[model samples]
Target chain A: MKTVIRSTTLADKLLFIALTTAAVAGIFYSREAMPKGSDVIIEVDGRTAYTLALDTDRVLSVPGPYGNTVVEIKGGRVRVKEAHCPNRLCEKQGWITRGAIVCLPNHIVISVGGKTENLPKGLDAVTG
Target chain B: MKAVKVLTVLLLLTATAVSCSNGPVEYRKTKPLMDTIVTITVVSESDRKADEAIESAFSVISRFSDKIDFFKHTSELSAVNRNAGIAAVTVSPETLGVIERALYIAKISGGAFDPTIGPEIRMWDFAKKVRPSDEEIRKNLPLVNYRDIVVDRSRSTVFLRKRGMLMDLGGIAKGYAADLALADLKKEGIAAGIVAAAGDIRAFGLKPGGEAWRVGIMNPRQKSKADELIATARLSNKAVSTSGDYERYFIENGRRYHHILDPKTGYPAAGCRSVTVISDDGIFADGFTTAVFVLGPEKGMRLVRDCGADALIIDRDGGVHTTPGLKKMVAFENGH
Candidate 1:
């Protein structure tokens, strides 16, 4: 059987090329805007409850086994604002820009996550 | 047109390529145990399976911690300390094994990392910023002899010959717990993972894409948060640990007093700022870091070579030193 085909116009080719280029550029642009600093992740009882940008200053009351673990983020740093755990070790940790702040009695873990530009392999752990 | 069709196909292909980079999702859980945050990361096909493996790993670490906790009144180590100078205290095989390793390190390190430094450690409360009196340190120094502790491997009993002598496995127990956690992960059939308990890290197998786990050594004198790491090392089926003066310390009169004490002086080891040891066994790496810190760079490197382990030492002046083996494995951040 003979096949019938429609010929493409220059305008149609230009439109298709422009759209593809724009789509590819958009993807790359989004990747660049991912995260310059990091994100504060709050986990309660083995599940994530909040993932907020570190640049934003906010106070979050995350509920856990015992009570709310008050978390504060400011100036790209995170801390345990308040916790009901008897030891208050988390509060004593003060401000941390990386790693984690854990309130064991509350079953809460606050960690920093995002792309660290220089570390291409990504840090599995930090030993001190 | 045909050109449009070709471009559409190319667009689909690009999207697929972009999304495929994220091969397998990782399941990670962090909990506070053994005086630090213990994070277990597993790359698994199913979330439920990963979660089970992680929980089992955590349970294994928790149980091991209970057996060796120096502060916990009911722990086996506590029982042994309670029976010091009295009689041999019976312990589990696991406890005996850890104690044996501690003793071995103590012998090799020439008692620099003695398990009997417990009496001195208890005197200085880092949290309260309290320092013990000179008299107290001098008194406890004599009791800090690793030779005083006797172990009976046949019967799994440990004895301290001195009345006030205390055996604190804090230096080495966490690494052993991390090693156990990794074993649990393997037993659960998790392909690749890392068990990190603060400064003690045990990594095994390649990641989902056959890449090794990368660990950063925290700079002892980090100027900023972004400049946390002095070096990074790629590890697979290995353990890397760091003992840093920065971890626990208090500054008084422009001098820093840290927790890692030299058994000879009953004071903080001042030769090095931090010592990072990499070894096939987590317990060895963890204990060696403390030993090396107290031994200084020249002597520490000798001990590292004798034990067939690698070390990265940051001296009191913030100078970087590494053994030949570690120099080949680690990538320095500042081109050291």
Candidate 2:
């Protein structure tokens, strides 16, 4: 069956599609400015070495060379669940969002969406 | 037009928050040149780039991997070993810097931290291993005066007064690199990270989880195991370095000859098996770690304190002597 469409309506539809695409692209490219309120917790080898909560402006640091891992907390899952460093794998594994973050080598994991990662990686481990 | 303006404003805000980005970026780096397996984690937002920059810097300063390292050559020191007695020779900038730091440590240790022990080290032959004659030791003893070896920073010059004198910075260079990397990371927009070069390390900043960097001081006696958790520090914009003899030493005729040699006597300093130096500057830790090995804990502690540096000395008897402000960092139950 043939469908009749108005020329003016078609032009409006095209403009709407273009505007929608531009808005989505703009948001995706400039995402860092989107006020990411999510936080994270780092567990190395099943040990909670860091409990990071991200909100405003902050940077963090923590030790490394960990392997073998276990993560806790719900909602935001901790990755890097296993490694070789006597359950100290959290240091070796990678970061984790509510979605994913894990390091197979060190079994390090950063849990996301569960807690706030306000501190840097190494602030709590060292005295400086 | 309003939406466009908002997007531009947001872009500017992210740019302003470049160093302020606390996004947990796991840092994993490896380098074959320094013979190190290094892994660093930072909230720099781009942990991948941080690792790349550090590795790149190591390549830039590597003496073992590049031809440019010849500029910082210790060949003159080797030349002294070849020519038992000659007038002082000029040295390169890199050599001069290492020697100057060694001399500084020497003065701090009050002769205990001498750098002119090159001849003595050659006699003992810990690096290669072939003991020299007693006559050779006597001859070299006169040559091992750190005070005699002079360095002129302005002119970038060094002179071995007694001729056969040599200066080795095996203690401090690695520490310097670690400090440099941490500093470099900050300069390169990585305000949070750590650098461990052959066990000489330093860390700065906190984890995204609001915790400090927990460095594990491996057991000198046991490679695979940690002796005890000597310390877990915040590194809060600081550097650290650890020197030990359990791995790099020679057991000759029931005697163990380690690399940490005293400049005055040409022998390994007695009193400690390992010395862990924690300082704001990696270079100081490097020079002081060896200085402590030469100076012993009492004088070493004094020298380190005078220099505004900190230390953790694991004594020959397996005791730990931590600095005044470092006692809290030393977790002996889980440290090396």
Candidate 3:
């Protein structure tokens, strides 16, 4: 019983250490990981910027640089998919899937959101 | 006995776990751009899918056009403009809401924030026209009266019984728009964020790591560098708007012509350079700031303090004053 308890504690310690290491590693990796191809350059009120893969556009929106300056692509139209900013003006802005996503108030520009990656997909989120 | 101890340990662990949140709920980016004389900060993050929301929020509030401005045109207010003689004619929900808030400010300012000063604003040539003669000013003076405009919230309409009466919401629209945008961000799954329209700024939730969003208060006198910063405000959802004479003004015979007009004499208020109000709604903040500017600092501070909102005031002499909340949350970078 004593040996079993010791082994259990050892396993718990190892798991905690692994999780801590993975969390730090993930942050560093995400900061450095580069897309294999061109990214869409989003221009904001002028400067504050962000970079995202095409897949991230639907879930994340950074508006000027104010409100949900959202842009969505649908039916050959690039529209502001949704926003709570009165009147859903971002929804009226229409879409841009390729180049830059501009949120003037937030100053977030996704210079790359929707480009295909020719590089092999090795490190899925789980692997990280 | 052993089972009870184990249960107690489990309860403690559960309590600790419950206290820890998932992560920092928001992110932001600030820059020095807007008027070139001041710095603009914008932060963004998502609690949901479908990005690109900020772009849509800003253009609507920031755009300056005669058309599509909720302030300039609402069905009820339009009807009032057409009816010059009625003491109070019926209006709509949008107009009624705006006018009702305008009256609140008007009463608070002791008549400084009047929505009926539309003709006076026109006479100044700040938004439209070049200028008006003294006769033109006097002729329209009688039309400016918040008392003449009544609101029936239950009926959902505003009535202007007087002729030539127009309610201009330019004072509050930007702040209101900013408030709307911030709300929109939260609705779209922004756990933490900040939104501003030129001067109307609103922040919410937590920083990306649960830290507060630090907002730098620009020095109105210097116009370069924010002399103060308001940090540690835990308000996840609120709007901050400042009205200053710096933006639009003209020189005529060595005097400045600012946009905010007092309904009494139909001219700019005597003192104060800027008045900033922070609240949960941009519309209230926007209009209150303008009205406060017209009302001057002493009363402005009282109104802000009474409403439990925060405010920063820069007097005409370049003196900076703040309400209790501003003094607590704001740090003066250079003797502010």
Q: Choose the strongest candidate by TM-score.
A: 1
- What is the Cα-based lDDT of residue B46 in candidate 3? 41
Q: What is the C-alpha lDDT of each candidate?
A: 0.83, 0.56, 0.54
Model 1 interface DockQ: 0.39
Per-residue lDDT tens digits for candidate 1, residues A39-62, read 887777767788888889999888
Comparing candidate 2 with candidate 3, which one achieves the higher TM-score? Answer: 2
In order of appearance, the predictions have TM-scores of 0.83, 0.60, 0.58
Q: Give the CAPRI class of candidate 3.
A: incorrect
lDDT of 3: 0.54
Per-residue lDDT tens digits of candidate 1, residues B1-336?
666777678787989887766556677877778756788889987889999999999999999989997767789999999999999999998899999999999999898789999899888766446889999999888899999999998888999999999998989988999889988898999978988887799998888878888898888887765577799999998899999887667788999988889999998989999999999989999999999999999999999999999999999998888888887779999744
Measured against the native two-chain assembly using Cα atoms, what DockQ does each of the candidate structures obtain, in the order listed?
0.39, 0.05, 0.04
Q: What docking tier does model 2 reach?
A: incorrect
Which portions of model 1 show Cα errors greater than 4 Å? A1-97, A106-121, B1-10, B17-26, B45-48
lDDT of 1: 0.83
